[model samples]
Target: MDDLASFLRNRRARVVPAEVGIATDTRRRVEGLRREEVAHLSGVSVDYYVRLEQGRATQPSEQVLDALARVLGLDATEREHLDRLARRPRRRTKPPAGKVRPELQRMLDLVAGAPAMIMNHRTDVLAGNNLAALLFGRPLPELNTARHLFLEEDERGLYADWDTCTLDVVGHLRLSAGKYPDDPRLASLIGELAMGSDRFRRLWARADVCARTHGPKRYRHPLVGRLDLHQETFAVPGESGLELVVLSAAPGTPAEDGLRLLAGFAAG
Candidate 1:
């Protein structure tokens, strides 16, 4: 099935009818709102909704999208994804070259006592500082973070909560797929993960969407034991699809001391 159609169907299967004030009964065969029910609630005709799910209606009006989004109870990120999926896709463009600018590399090196790295939409680690290399226990070049989490046995053990981390990463990739529908590399990466990992396949089918901007992440490092750090992501100016991620711990915390130790190790 097409991405747009599959996305709508997946989301439709998740909304609870009672949560939206529609009474539920055992007679209901589907798990979530039925297609006709969605049409009625969203102020659209059943034929149009069905056409949408079949991927026949490509250009939905803003009013229609807004109504569907409300009925589906889509979050801000999901709403944006819905809009993207509804619009006509442009011609396929070449994926980003995944090159880290010399200035950006210098910036990564200058970030003190923290692990910093640059990544693209596909989680390709374009570049990383010495501390980052120590933190991940692997060289950053040619490392796809998503692949590491799902496919590598040793790397999977680093996350204190691996399942949640993998889910969030999958959601981020889903959002990227919506934006860059024709990116062959991104498509290949998704296919590879799906074929290699059952967990990835399950999460990918959920149609979840997310953006990893800032959050606290816990890691179980061989050297540090447990390190809790907050991640900050910045989009590189003038560079499309590139983000700078820096992981730092709060002041005076044990995590901070662990970072200091890691920094020393990097220095050594």
Candidate 2:
């Protein structure tokens, strides 16, 4: 499970002193908003806010989240992130039918230059080639990526920026759940993660939502020291539970060399 305290600490650290208009006094001990200050700004009791920051509050309402977002000066993206952390419930419905079409798999394979993988709303690795396996570790065809990250021990070592990746994974899941509220598979995945990983539970409760689009990713490959790549997701036309992700690096950088080495490893 992810450490909620750690997540909160990271979020708290990202807000600069200037960003919040809090002049840093010479005697200030804490870097960001004091617990009492945050509580006052959010209109909640200091004790309650402290507990929430400590990851003790099991659930927080939308109003509280909105207040917290306002006080924290969260952007639209960050406010949505806070909501995801506040609103994830415990009970779960069945998961949606999470299967990739054969034609989609063929199409994924046809993207030979860029490493690609097919994933469902639940982040299940449905299909991919040897290159994908090498890049993302062996495909967890039966497991959701969130589960692998939070429940599996290997994930911490696998993802270079685990916290950022966690945000992406959870945000994508939130978006999918919002888009398909009745999707049984997605619901089940959320429930399973919540039950199995306290960190996932904390994040889900915040109610963050994001569409997985294009982004830069840095990976510390087990075999290749470090590589930075760009990830792009393409929606599959007419397919409900599948999307294709492609990873690419700039043509002449060290990242390209690492990717080429990775491809060669896959080829062998």
Best by TM-score: 1
When superposed on Cα atoms, how far off is each prediction in RMSD? 1.7, 6.8
Give the per-residue lDDT of model 1 (tens digit) for 1-268: 1277888899999999999888978887888999999999999999999999998887889999999999999999999888888883644435566788899999889989989999999999999999999988988995888998999843348888787789889999998898788888889999999999999899998989999799988899899878999999998888878899999999999999999998888878
Task: Show how many residue pairs clash in every candidate, following the order shown.
Answer: 0, 18
38: Cα error in model 2, Å? 18
lDDT of model number 2:
0.72
> Candidate 1: which stretches are off by over 4 Å?
90-94, 154-156
TM for every model, in the order presented, reads 0.95, 0.63
| lDDT per residue (tens digit) for residues 93-203 in model 2 | 344456777787787777765678888777888887667787767764754678878777444476777788887888778766754556766677788888888777777
lDDT of all predictions: 0.88, 0.72
